[model samples]
Target: MSLQTDDLLSVQDVHVGFGEFTALDGAHLHIARGGITGMVGPNGAGKSTLFNVLGGQQAHQGGRVLFDGQDITHWSVHRRAQAGLTRTFQISREMGALTVLENLLLAAPQQPGEKLWHALLNTAAARQHEAQAMAQAQALLERVGLWRLAHERADSLSGGQKKLLELCRALMLKPRLVLLDEPAAGVNPVLVSEIADFIRSLQAEGMSFAIVEHNMDMIAALCDPVYVLAQGKVLTQGSFAQVSAHAQVVEAYLGGVA
Candidate 1:
């Protein structure tokens, strides 16, 4: 599909391979600005590989990635983050030793204290910026219902809590778009609801997201324009009801009869 003027992220005819194995074959999708997009496919369908490609973790053999009208096919992971693209993994990336509040602080972009000279020579300005980051982090933690445990180490969080923390950290970056991998994978029903609610809140405030998930409930609840991938290529794209009723989509999940 061609990229539209309002698309926040787009992948055009992307390809990836490893020796005899081809993980992705000319896959393409567009994430509209300020909207949530869902990606669902079976295991080994190249979903994860596609996420890596967009997040700058894996290099595509061909095609290009455009974010906000800028070509970022060769951008590095941190560069992508700096340019308003950030992601959360299937596995949490929290710093176990750090307190929950500290983790959010670290994720905030461009802390002045990151430079040695600023830490020593510009203590006043560095503290001002840090105080602002701390305020923002606390606000996010409170919104996610984690301010109660702000002083606790990240490892102390349960699987669901860690997922929430990951979401909170991504917000600290003020990302224009976030690639979420299974936000409700192993989370309990209560926390799953919380995650979904949190996402809806963010979406209303103009945060765009592209999520990879297996939970149909979450997908149906949150996604508008969903992309269904089978055998590494998009099988169909539409609303949840439309794509779920597609013949190929059903056959992809439930093997077709001979």
Candidate 2:
């Protein structure tokens, strides 16, 4: 199928397998620019594997991936991130010992000080990059209501806070599309709402997202074109209300609960 003009990430007939197991079978999906695309399915429906494929962590044997009009199916994870694609995990991957601000600084793409020669010479560029990273980190922390904890060890934060930190780290790269595995998992109801609000705010600022989540509330409230996967393929794609009413989607994902 032809990718729409507004589509940012396009997965076309992608296939993945490991020995006898097929993780994805000709999966096709599109993430629209400046929109939040929701993905929902039951366990073993290949959601995480799909995320891995998009993040360049998994190698697919067939099909193509296009990002911003570029064929990037073979790109490395670092390359993808540099090309404006980044992701957050279901489980927070924050550095436990690092201070909150330090974590974000480490995520900044390029720091002159990271080079030994630049550090030895104490280059002005290094100082400037570091100063800029610090300012960005501070602003992000404040936006997430974590500025007061910027100096605290990342490990000391609550589960929800750690998720926020992970999201912020991904944002430090200034990515255009963020693949969120499950932003609401393990978060308190209040914090989940706050995180949803934060995501909506980011979307308003023109950041696109593809979210895999089981929290139907967040999916229904934040997503427009929701895709439901079953047996390693898209079972349906539509507004939450429409998909929830589909008999197959209800049976496959909600076990008739819907």
| Candidate No. with top TM-score | 2
lDDT of 2 by residue, 45-134 (tens): 899999999999999999999999999999999999999999998888899999999899999988523576765787897777778889
List CA RMSD, all candidates.
Answer: 2.0, 1.9
Give the runs in model 2 whose Cα sits over 4 Å from its true position. Answer: 111-114, 254-258
lDDT of 1 by residue, 18-49 (tens): 88888999998999999999999887788889
Q: Given candidate 2, what's the lDDT at residue 159? A: 92
**So what's the TM-score on candidate 1?**
0.95
